[model samples]
Target: MPCCPFCSSDMVYPLLNTLRCKRCKNIWKEGEENPGRPAACGSEGTSLRIRKKTDPLETRMKRKLDEYLTRSKGKFCFSAMPWQAGDISQELFMRYLKRCVKDRSLAEEKDRYGRTWYLRP
Candidate 1:
């Protein structure tokens, strides 16, 4: 996930092998000038920028949850919950996560505590 250059928002999408910042609509390609990499600037307006990179399934889920919480303006009520989030609910989230893992062909992953989670394989 990439952070926005102007607002530090975690809305990013990959376009043509380049990372694009959704908030500011900034496009950066690897090996290019600036390269859209996260940088902590001390001058003004921008602080720390989060890199947009491929992440583990679990990590993605965490990021999604965090984003949801932030977007909902504290209206989200889940805490310490693990989910993938298609529409809503734990079951939907789990199902969505399983489908994602299968689609991404990451069928051989174990949870942090060695629990078999993905439905791929």
Candidate 2:
């Protein structure tokens, strides 16, 4: 039930041969005086390492598309093509939208003037 030196959280647990802090996610060995700081490079024992989570490309595209549709009243003319997500190229953006339509996440409708509109299903 030792406290985390880095975050001062009491949510510390033994992981294999080391202690892990739930709050800061830092790992250190048991009975170590300074578990808050990482060991010097090339020294024995574990050093601090942090991993960041990132969404996949398709997931990111879907999120961006959802945001765009919401802003555009849940529908927009396909030909006008006003939405551009981040640094993605026009071709990639259209490809993602077309995939969504194919998967039935988005519906494609044609007006009397033969203009195509993409809308949420």
Stretches > 4 Å off in candidate 1: 31-121
lDDT of every predicted structure (CA atoms): 0.49, 0.66
TM-score of each: 0.25, 0.48
Residue pairs with clashing backbones, model 1: none
- What is the RMSD of candidate 2? 13.9
For model 1, residues 52-95, the per-residue Cα lDDT tens digits are 54654456555664575566553332343344444234653455
lDDT by residue (tens digit), candidate 2, 47-120: 54322226644666677778768777988785666655353445666777888889898898999999888898
Q: How many steric clashes between backbone atoms does each model show?
A: 0, 0
TM-score of 1: 0.25
lDDT of 1: 0.49
